[model samples]
Target chain A: MSRYLIQFAYDGGSFSGYQIQPNALTVQEELEKKLSILAQRKIEVVGSSRTDAGVHASQQFAHFDCPVPIQKDWVYRLNRMLPHALAVISIEQVADDFHARFDALSRTYHYWIVRKKTPLRRHDTYWFEAPLDLEAMNAACQILFQYIDFECFSKVKTDVFTFDCTIQKAIWTEEGDFLKFTIQANRFLRGMVRAIVGTLLEVGEGKLKPEDLHQIIQSKDRNQAGRAVPAHGLHLVEVKYK
Target chain B: MSRYLIQFAYDGGSFSGYQIQPNALTVQEELEKKLSILAQRKIEVVGSSRTDAGVHASQQFAHFDCPVPIQKDWVYRLNRMLPHALAVISIEQVADDFHARFDALSRTYHYWIVRKKTPLRRHDTYWFEAPLDLEAMNAACQILFQYIDFECFSKVKTDVFTFDCTIQKAIWTEEGDFLKFTIQANRFLRGMVRAIVGTLLEVGEGKLKPEDLHQIIQSKDRNQAGRAVPAHGLHLVEVKYK
Candidate 1:
């Protein structure tokens, strides 16, 4: 059997999520159905990450094994067969032992928030009517670097074993009228980035003190965290593997 | 009566166009309906330009007259009442003789073409799969500045009285994987920018010679031009009046 590593991108607006479910449309199911048809056999794809519904991905990696080698033009042919909102950008042969999800080293995410009200980008970016205090938000973001446990920000009843994650980079930048938060971590718990952004927004809005973030992290309670931000503003920017 | 000039923005994917059409939803109709409800009086808005269906506008201008003066806070209030995809950014009192379309001094347009295949921006930008000769396209763009008449690119059956428009700036810039064409002019005829982009793409693809653009403009026939590019890639960047 030959294993192939596929790099793809998708707009997750119309999908339930990346995982497959009965009676629900998903990115994985769509790709598998097409690949199976092309190969004239059943095929299953293993994704690097399971992004939530309405969350976009700029670069996502996956792996699939086939009994026969595929042509180089299969990448272009698969793209044409898929919907315009999903594309298979590249395909390459990989070692049979390489798995997309288990063999990843780190991942990065970006959350976009438009400070000024813009109708053109309303759907693509989250709109914050009130002015954000960038300095305060940045100060609070510094607290995240000191903590390795993020149980306060993780979603409840998640399948992951532990909430420990080493966050390498968490920085906010302002571009024109948009404020973006880019975070890189060894791994992320479900809904962690959104919860972090929500808490940072509270700091920006003066509802919570910057130092209070430390207390919230120590509390280890989901309720201590701020509300989760909308999914549309979140994007899986990159996935790294060694 | 007081005349007010409003700077607006909208995602044109959902509506038919900017103008009111029978049995079709439009940006004008939506705003008029909301204004009537708010003011308890019938209202009509005259937009700076009637954008075609599926064309987006980042900073469109419009004017409407009301019997009573409006407060500064009306900008935020109107935005709350408008749909999420449409917004009124600024409102200012204007002279009674001022008209949004006729009094405009200049208009700017931006066309986005993604060189790489990206699924996330499929609906937002045009995808050009083949490698583009951007330098050749820029060279062709420079030729556009020498011509004052663009009757060849204008849509047929257009009601404009004159076919002459001063091209102030026409340049193409490459940023990362995206190529953007920005043009500023005193006025534009219908389908003018799209036709220009289409012909330029033909030149970039080696399907048409760069010098043929000047010949096509001199022909002054719509049939002499290439196909009009899709409307989604076109954006009304700015409208200026002095």
Candidate 2:
């Protein structure tokens, strides 16, 4: 059997989530189903990230083993079978032992916020009308890299061995009427990004001081942090590998 | 009775067109249907521009006659009743004699072209991979201002009293990874903006000379013009009034 890795993008609003469930549609389920039909056999796929429902992905990776070698027309044929929301950007043959999840070095996420009522960007962006202080928000992002434990931002009941995470970069950039928050990390816990975003927004809103994030992270209490932002505004942008 | 003018926006993929017709969903029909329900009386609306199917509008206006005066909570309540793809930005009372169609002085349309497969912008932007010559396209736009009749760039079977239109502004602007064509005219013929965009793309592709547009316009024959571009990439951005 040969292992194949494919990079894809999906609109998260179309599926319940990335992982397979009993009744709801999912990205992994659709990919496995389409791949199995193409290969004429059952195929199980492993994704690098299990993004939440309504969380979009610009670049996601998955690996699967197939008895037949990679077909030249597989990407084109697979895309034709996938829905408009799910698309396979590219595919390549990888070593049999190369794991999509374990081999990933880092992952990046973006949270998009728009000011006015936008019809085109409704599904993916959060409409935030209040004035924001970007300098304060950026200052809060700096506090994230100072700590390795993000338990304050993660979901309380998640099953995880450790809450330690290395944040490589975190910054907020203003792009014409949109405010985008970008964060890159070695690893993330469930609901970590959204919770961080919501906490940072309080800083922008003048409710939480920039230095308060340090205490929140030190507290390591989920309730100590701000509320978790909506899943629709968050996106899984890139998954990096060494 | 009072005439109220509402400035709104819509994703044209949600409707067949701006006009009401048999056995088809339309923006005008939706507005009339909802307004009728809100007023508890039959309400008729007249749109400033009849946009084509699959086209989008960032800002559009429609005037409707109501038995009652403008309601304070109409905008908020109407938006709740509208679909996610449709929204009411604002509403105000206009003069009883004011005409939505005839009182409009000019209209601005934008055609967005992107060079990459943007999954987020798929519905509103045309994915064009060719290297465009903006200088050639801009030169062709300047030539448009020198002429009045645009018969060659209009649909062949359209019914209109005259084909003359006054060009106020026409130019192509590069907006960081996207090419946008903006055109404002006192009036337009059927399929005029899209046909002009398609023919200008030929100039950018080196298929047609920039000067060739002069002859094409003078031909006054629809067969002389290039094919009309897809409607999805076009947007009715503005409608000015005296």
TM-score to true structure, per model? 0.95, 0.80
Q: How well is candidate 1 docked (DockQ)?
A: 0.67
lDDT of 1 by residue, B1-242 (tens): 99989888988887888999999989999889887777678988999988888888989998999997677687788888888878888889899989999999999999999976787677668988787788888899888988999999999988999999999998889988898999999999999999999999998898888888888999999888889999989989899999
Relative to the true structure, candidate 1 has a C-alpha RMSD (angstroms) of: 1.9
Over B1-242, each residue of candidate 2 has an lDDT whose tens digit, in order, gives 88889999999988898999999999998888888898998999999999999999999999988888778888877877887678888989889899989999999999999775556777898878788899999999999999999999888888898999999999999998699999999999989999999999999999999999999999999888888999999999999988
Q: What's the true lDDT of residue B11 in model 1?
A: 80
* Per-model lDDT: 0.89, 0.91
**Which candidate should be chosen as best, given lDDT against the real structure?**
2
User: Over the full model, what C-alpha lDDT does candidate 1 score relative to the true structure?
Assistant: 0.89
Pull out the clashing pairs in model 2: none
* Residue A29, candidate 1: alpha-carbon lDDT: 93
- Choose the strongest candidate by TM-score: 1
Residue-level lDDT tens digits of model 1 in A1-242: 99999898888787888889899889999899988988999999999999988888888899999997798788888988888878888989899999999998899999999876776676568998786788989898889999999999999979988899999999899998899999999889999999999999999999999999999999999999999999989889899998
What local lDDT does model 2 show for residue B100? 88
List model 2 lDDT by residue over A1-242, tens digit each: 89999899988988998999999999999999999998999999999999999899999999999997778888878877888688788989898899999999999999999876677888899878788899999999988888998889989889899999999999999998799999999889999999999999999999999999988999999999999888999999999987
